[model samples]
Target: MSQIPLEHILLLSAVLFCLGLLAVITKRHAVVVLMGVELIFNAANLNLVAFSRYDPSLLQGQLFSLFVIVVAAAEAAVALAIVLRVYQHFKTANLNEIATIDK
Candidate 1:
């Protein structure tokens, strides 16, 4: 049985990153945008893990990925808190409807 190539993982991560970019650009819902951000973060993490698996000399990629995961978790928490506050103030989570405070 043949093992899968690391290039395949990189390609998949690229596709996911593109899809997340599209979602962030096209979606108007706050939660959907958040999901897109998470997807992008995961794609980057996937790339890090893939590189770590393929390169024996670098354990740093995997360690960096762990740090990214932790940061992503904190980002999610803060983002969700902000989203909830926006929902409470606006009564909806649609990004299009949420006006800038200064505007």
Candidate 2:
């Protein structure tokens, strides 16, 4: 069986990172921004897995990736909760509108 190239894997990771950055920068909705952050995390995870494939130990990369996944899940939950509260308090999820918190 032919194995995939490391360069290709890194390229995919780069693409994912860029897309996530674009989403975070261009989107105004809090949920969309959260999704973007998740994308970035996924990209990092992919890189970790890919690099782990080349390592002799083989376990370190996968273990780190698993840890990252757990942290990301927790972060997403807390972030969504915060977003929900913000929406409840402000009646809008747009980040720009939420900036005017003095009202």
Candidate 3:
């Protein structure tokens, strides 16, 4: 049986990262942007896990990936709180419309 190559995982992660960046740039909704950020985080996680699998001697990547997951969870909590506050203040979740707080 042929083993899957590490390059395949890296390529998949890269594609996901690019898509997430595009979503963050082009989406107008705050929630959509948040989702893009989550996607990017997951891409980094996939890369870490893939690297860990390819090279068993390096456990740091997996440990760092765990830390990343924790950080991502905390970020999501804070971001959701902010989004809720924005919705409460503006009565809308559109990123463009939430600029009223800029003053």
Q: Give the candidate number with the greatest TM-score.
A: 2
Stretch of 10 with least lDDT, candidate 2: 54-63
lDDT of 2 by residue, 1-103 (tens): 9979999999999999999999999999999999999999999999999999998676888999999999999999999999999999999999999997766
Q: Residue 37 CA error for candidate 1 (Å)? A: 0.5
lDDT of 1 by residue, 6-97 (tens): 88999999999999999999999998998999999999999998888878898988999999999999999999999999899888898877
The per-model lDDT (C-alpha) reads 0.91, 0.95, 0.92
Question: Higher-lDDT candidate among 1 and 2?
Answer: 2
- Candidate 2's C-alpha runs over 4 A off are 101-103
Candidate 2 vs candidate 3: the lDDT winner is: 2
Model 3: per-residue lDDT, tens digit, 23-93?
99999899999999999999999999988887888898899899999999999999999999989978899
Candidate 1 collision pairs:
none
